[model samples]
Target: GVDQLETYFGAYLPQFFYAMLAPLTLFVYVCTINVTSAVILLICVPLIPVSIAAVQTWAKKLLSKYWDQYTALGDTFLENLQGLTTLKIYQADEYKNSQMNEESEKFRKITMKVLTMQLNSISIMDFVAYGGAALGLIVSVLQFRSGHIDMAGCLLIILLSADFFIPMRQLGSFFHIAMNGMAASDKIFHFLDMKESEKGNQEFPDNHNISFRNVQFAYEAQRPILKNINVECPMGSFTAIVGESGCGKSTFAGILTKKNENFGGSITIGGVRLSDISEKSLMENVTYISHQSYMFKGTIRDNLRMSDPDAADDKMWEVLRSVKLDGYIKEQGGLDMKLNEQASNLSGGQRQRLALARALMRDNSVYIFDEATSNIDVESEDDIMAEVHNLARTKTVILISHRLANVVKADNIYVFSDGYVAECGKHEALLEKNGIYASLWNTQCEMENI
Candidate 1:
């Protein structure tokens, strides 16, 4: 597409300029030689510019529709390519191919319409230019017969009349290129005008005390994910937000990370409203890590450097050791080890620990682990939970998990149920009530015993 654009512009730009100037320039000289024929030619001049404007106005809409269809069809094709393996696994490849064909057909129809409009516009310009030239020739012959102009003058009138309309003929061929360029420019300007995320200049302090008062949120109306959820997470504390899947515990973590900004109620960190703190300052003091953390295709050193580029080798090893991954990494060629795409070479536990090490490199005042230990062996979970406990001694730590055992020693725990806080207390206190939290725990306990 980029190469097409470049070629289109290169071919049409000079022709477009010459089309505008050549006819007008020749018309003046034609008038000097034969006024009658030049007047006939001039009569057609206003009509071409006006018709060009009208055709261009109409082509603007068609061009936009054509581009939209082209993009959609490309996206469908790309999706089919990326999901080909999944389609084959499920024996649904033919169905996906049929879907792609339908999109391609739709794009083809729009493309035909665009070409029709371009040719139709060019046809109108061709008719006017030729009609004017014919009229000029007829007028020049009449003047010649009456002896109002000499033979040389008459001959010049006929030749110059063809020249007069030649520029318009060239411009007719450039119609598609000019319109496409304008359309592309309009789209870029629209992107430039898009609004950025709203933030403030207020800086966050060293304090990491966090609180959410009557916080409310929902991905969609009537299907609320969080409802007036009030909670507190003090600095230097280990706070656990635990619940069954789909009970809004992850949504609660999302709110703290400011992903769902339109939620109701105020959330503050260090006494400053989340919206009030500058993005740079807030990120420096707070960060989020999840079990599904992405490890890009690069060396281990490259991935760790993304968190803190200037971090020394010793610091990287220290964090790796803290997560109990240093010994394995050291055995596997140390930090220079190459990671496959999505870190497929490592086990799930190794990937999560590497993600943890990357997160720790930032030294943020508050860390939110949104289900950071959802899967993996018990040893890895124990190692990560222990590290989280140690980090909570200074930096604020908030854990979101469904594994009841992991949060038993948390300083405080908030059990959520159907978008609301069902219980808030230490693990033992919540267990004593034998309510929703106790029920979930007891079910898991019995399953473990089995």
Candidate 2:
């Protein structure tokens, strides 16, 4: 899009403007030299633009289809590349490769069509531009032979006649660039017209308590992920949201973190609706940490300081120790330890722990961990969850996890199934009632024993 915009402004637009004005200016001088030759040039001038416009109408639609196919193929290729390892593990690499080849073929066909349109347009444009100039030149020579115009006038008419086609001819070559720029402009305008999330000026309370009442949400029409869900986590309480994958456990966490905001019903913190709270105020009061933590290639201290730039060395150590990574950090040369790109040097557990430490640096009133412990070792998971439980002593904590054992002591547990809350209570209470949570607990317990 940026490249198209650059070409549009830098080349096509300038030449198009010159084409619009230059011909009329040249037409006046040609008339003064020989009226008959000038009329010939004038008649041919409109044919060049008319032919270009006719070609443009066809090329425009072709370019749009070309871009769509090209982007879709790219997305499919990237997705397949990322999952190459898994595809091989499942012994489906050849099948997946075949799918990619099929998509590429579709893209190739669309590309051929686009090139055909461009070539066809160029052919028509070449005929009009050169043909128009040829007709004017022939007329000027005739007028010169008949003594209607002198030698100097004939030469001037011929010389200036070439300049007449220069701008329009150049525009012919840049027609594709103009088409791409127009398509890019359509997307840019649509993006600019999109409505941003509404924000409010009212300040949120320091004591953050979260509640979702009759909440319903869906990524698209006819496919709801969360339905009429109700849950509560008052200040100084630990709440657990447990469900099978794809049952909207993560979506619920996203709602609280404001990553997914367009939904039905109400989610509020302390008596204020989540939508009404300013993003700045919400960030200051709530922090959401997930399993896939992004770490830039920089010193450990650099990453931690991003959470709170004013954090002192002791404050960094405090958070690190809380996650039980202080001893490891000290052994590795403290806060100056350099993390490789994407923190590749650190183990998965270490990366997750480091992310947890960063989240701890923020003094938010509520913290939600979206499977932050899912990829870590058992020991690290225990230490991190223990520290998180301690942190919930003064702040609201929402834990969304598949591991039910860790949340057995939670103040309340909400079990989601098929997009709605099936049960809500303490672990012991749910087990006593033999509900969804009880069934999940039993299954996990059995797996652990094996």
Candidate 3:
């Protein structure tokens, strides 16, 4: 759309220039030059249009590089704003400013180069248009002296010549504007060309059993995050996954949510391959809540309603009560109280509980908590964990946590290490084995005593 406006102006320049110049120039010289002299002067008018059209075509091709730089400038500004808080905390404001200034200066320099090219083209076009007319007038006068034409006829020829080239000169300027607009259009077309992922053909099952068969995955291809991970989550039982930091704990949860898809082997939900299930259908059955719960700016009711848009006010309060958050909601002035950006108005624990309530409202068949209890206070954590355990009775629950205590009550526990499942069994069974799981358990136990 922006490009079209630029093209319109570029295409119209020639017409505008000639209309203004022809009448004025002809009016000035009509009473002065003889017929033969005027004919010679009129020859200069064609030069204006021809010169502008040719110059503009050449200049338009050169302006595209500048347009790309402008897009880059916008992209950088977006990145800087997103990371402004990090920059302030690290005292790196100066460093970021320097980078921003450098990009801006480069962008300014490129724009100036485009402008310089345009100015030079215009100067040359003007010279050809008016200079040729003047030279033509000199020759016509010499011809008039030789009795070749009458005075009024000379004036008419000159006036007509000026009329011809004025439009062409203005057109040359318009070409530059049109080309800049086209350069912007090219970027928009490129963005629009991105392909969406194709949906699979297999039908999804109503039941909610999830299993991974020799699954392997990595954010980076060479650095596998989960290697040969295999777990079977029964339709209505709690499965807990515990691991050290960077040991593919969250990656496992992400896989269950289909947020991380680069993997080897297969993951099936209710005997249907995860890849085969459409994203929307898969999302309908599963919900993953992480520690950092994103709360958009709105009332508490607004956030809850996002889970099930048509949920009634009573249903919202009921879900909040289930998550043990209804009392706090009432204390905070009920659901009408607004939350600021990212829910800054709520404390860390309140935000997590709200997230839990939001998840409960959805009533997804499968619920995965990835470090959901790691940040909140112990009291809040326990209340939420109790709620989770209760939910486990009717829905499949997958808990991935760094804290060993959080998953102790899980029906089955899997200990992960170096992208592989190092141990899997009941918590006591793993303790008896005295392997990786036992070692990790002991380490945490010793830390707690200290």
* Cα TM-score per model: 0.89, 0.95, 0.78
What lDDT is reached at residue 201 by model 1? 86
Q: Write the per-residue lDDT of candidate 1 for residues 275-361, one digit (tens) a residue.
A: 888878877878899989999998999999999999999999999999999999989899999999999999988898999999999
Pairs clashing in candidate 2?
Answer: none
lDDT of 2: 0.87
- Best-fitting candidate, scored by TM-score: 2
Q: Write down the RMSD of candidate 2 (Cα, Å).
A: 1.7
Error of 2 at 225 (Å): 1.5
Best by the lDDT measure = 2
The digit string of per-residue lDDT tens for model 2 on 1-450 reads 457878888888898899989998988878888888887887787877898888778877777777777778889889888898999899998998888899899999988887888888888888888888888788889998998999999888888877888888898877787788887677678899999878766677765678899999999979999999998889889999999999999999888878898899988888988888888888887889899989999999999998999999999999999888999999999999999998999988889899999998998788888998997899989888898889878778898999998898799999999999999998889999997888899999999999
Off by over 4 Å in 2: none
Off by over 4 Å in 3: 1-86, 121-180, 201-203
lDDT of 1: 0.85
Candidate 2, residue 390: lDDT: 91
In candidate 2, how many clashes are counted?
Answer: 0
Tens digits of lDDT, candidate 3, 1-450: 364665656556545655567645764665364544444545555566566567656665666778777878888889989999999999998898899998899899998988898888888888886777667666656666777767766555545554545565556556566667766776777888967556666655778688899999988877889989899898898999988899999988887776777678988888888888888887877888999979989999899998999999999999888878889889988988889999998888889999999999888888999999987888889989999989988888999988888788899999999989988998899999999888988999999889
